[model samples]
Target: MGLFNKFFKGPEIDQAKSDANRSKMRACFDQAVENGTEYKLAAGYTEDVSRFNYGLVHGSKSKIGSLIVGWNEQNETIVVVPTTPDLDECSNPVYYRRSEIYKAYRNKYPTDAFIIYPDKKGYIAINIFEWLEDESNYIYIDQEAEAKAFTDFFMNHFKTK
Candidate 1:
């Protein structure tokens, strides 16, 4: 069954389980004093080098901003939340099913590399633009190790999707 296991796949995860996990996580987050800081997955994240000045390129209109990439247990999809102030305050977070991610890679900068993916939007540009001086451009996947962990988990999870 080793070959079959490699070619085939396991059954889909149960929706009930996903919902229960989401509920539990949400409860913990709600009870925390600092919800924003308490989300340890992305504590001191700043930017993704691959997303540098993406909006400045052609075929782009929307300015890039902050991003929060995390797993949404309730929906069983990757959630990309825009944290830029004022710009996307009224906008809803973007959800990407495993099938929606066309490609995923880690582009290297001078000393760091970051995860990048493309969806319906042009490119997954994080913290590449700012309209105001004090606008936020933080990414939760901060360090190279963290980025690698996220990339590995994401790639493995969607390898068959």
Candidate 2:
């Protein structure tokens, strides 16, 4: 029974590691909101969509590190901070302003911007068009609810009638 469980069960969740990651994400979020006028609305983890696969193959994402998304109200910007698996280190934050995102969302080629594939097993890809360098630089959000929240927040606050 023990052997069967060991083989069938998934890897155990490391509570300490999870907590550390959360703390690191929070710190990144805090830094983005350093200005008293800026505040965070939503945050979530993200993965870098592979340059070649684009989820067409099994290994379509580089899961080596994760990114933390932070929303700042003052500047209407989304800051993405990349971090290592253990959250011990982080790179510079990438800022995406509302005007730029809104423009991308309203792009002529709808598929060239934000895309949520209903048949793609809840895969949500955010493509900032030229801002992202190329089509292969899409940011993948794993959680559907978080993705929806991010879209909703952007629309509710920045979308013009």
Candidate 3:
């Protein structure tokens, strides 16, 4: 079996069980909130960023910007709402070029690694693993876990690690 299969290889979740997990996710988001930040679902959150929007030298024409739903360490999940916006505020949302903030973070971090595509309806594989394992930095997976639930079904509905 593959990684995804192994992860969810257990029995398929029944509707009731799935619904319950969904509810748990919902409650998790109710508690967390981001005060001020330009968040947009992104494009090319794939393992390989060489793809469109990601592989491009610029981002204006690329698709980015997603909705954040919930994130919590206690529950071990990051919730987000998948989005397909016409623009990405993080960048030129309009032109899709690299924004000041994006550049800063990308420069500061070793690599602009991402696990989730905040803009799309799926979990983005960000540098959470690095954040957790690396001693140089303290990555708080919990910070985003609660936010996962608040996101739409696309971002929500995920298994715990």
Candidate 4:
């Protein structure tokens, strides 16, 4: 019975392993920032931390950016990395102000859409609209619970008036 149990047991969650992976991912992102490269974290990289792969933004397609969600000492911080081709090498990274986020919500369709200001004609809405129109624009988060949690955290942190 012991042998059968051992053989059939699922993989145990190891704290040490999870910590090591987090450290490695952080280092990689830090290095990318230092080098000023276009580095968007892959979905797999955030699987352990449960960060939503896609980030919603506002503005025209030519003047758009990506929101890079990261953990700092267990606190979630989001940084916007511009994608415009006109951006020079010297432009500093833009970090989202928690106060500026008007609203956050999740939409369920063919693929889950974790949205920020889905309606309400604000500057942020344009980006959400664009992302919604383009099927390929959003990132694929593997776990539904993780996706919901990510949206919840964002909404909780930046409460809408």
Highest-lDDT candidate:
2
Report the C-alpha lDDT of model 2 over 1-92, residue by residue, as the tens digit: 99999999865554564445446557655664455125442233344545555566555546333455666655676666665544445677
lDDT of each: 0.41, 0.48, 0.30, 0.37
**How displaced is residue 17 in candidate 2, in Å?**
5.6
Q: Worst ten-residue run, lDDT, model 3?
A: 95-104
- Measured on C-alpha atoms, candidate 3 has an lDDT of 0.30
RMSD (Å) per prediction:
15.9, 10.3, 16.2, 12.5
Q: TM-score for model 3?
A: 0.23
The candidate, 2 or 3, that scores higher on lDDT is: 2
54: Cα error in model 1, Å: 20
Query: Residue 117 error for model 4, in Å?
Result: 5.1
lDDT of 4 by residue, 94-120 (tens): 444454555654445533444445335
lDDT of 3 by residue, 15-43 (tens): 55334433433333232324212232212
